[model samples]
Target: MEKKVQQYYRLKQKQKDIEKELAELRQDILNYCSEQETNETEIGRYKVKLVVQNRKEYDDAKLYETLSDPEVWRLLSKSDPAKVASLTKLNVISEDKIMHTYALKTVTLLQVDKK
Candidate 1:
């Protein structure tokens, strides 16, 4: 409804269009590189390269299970406030023990809606 909001939506639409075009071009480049059995393609002096990387990602739950160390679990795990509150109500955990664990935070967000 406002000028800034109108500009934001307009720019976002252009961004989505550009991103879609880029993705299509990237797929074409990747396909060309694969077909040529080369990692790069040259346009005059400029090169469009396809980089393949093997990234290492460890499963947190599996690693935690395998290690089975209380210290490790303490370091890796995060306390869910709702779960903690429910457990606290049942007398499973004390309020005093978890008193300083919670932190207060403020967050602001913008959401765009289509009408």
Candidate 2:
């Protein structure tokens, strides 16, 4: 009976930890989405920095210059092969459309950090 109780308590603790981590991940996603939705006009003259994960798959580094051009989208994609498999692009769209098209690559979910 004592052993069973110990196992149950351990399981409960593990569950609590998992739940905390999940909440953290949810918050991160919310923050990212919110930032993306921020109005460009309200952003003032400051530059926004995004730490994108994944780069090699999209060949994003070479395209940074083009993105910075006024006539083009001011975006950049950088990758660290050792950490992430490929590079990710920062595609800025209007607040009305936050979802990437079916043709664009799907967003990769990262592992939730333990609290």
lDDT per residue, candidate 1, 29-113, as tens digits?
Answer: 6666678987655755566665554322334454445436576356446445555466568865566655555554532221222
RMSD of each: 15.5, 15.6
Looking at model 1, report the run of 10 residues with the lowest lDDT sum. 106-115
**Tens-digit per-residue lDDT, 1-115, candidate 2:** 9999999999999999999998797567647646686422122443333333442342344334333444433222342332222112333423123222112343443333322
Query: Against the hidden reference, what TM-scores do the models get?
Result: 0.55, 0.32
Q: Which stretches of candidate 2 lie over 4 Å from their true place?
A: 38-115
Query: How far in Å is the alpha carbon of 91 misplaced in model 1?
Result: 38
Q: lDDT (0-100) at residue 108 of candidate 2?
A: 44
Clash numbers, per candidate: 0, 7
Residue 102 of candidate 1: its Cα lDDT?
Answer: 51
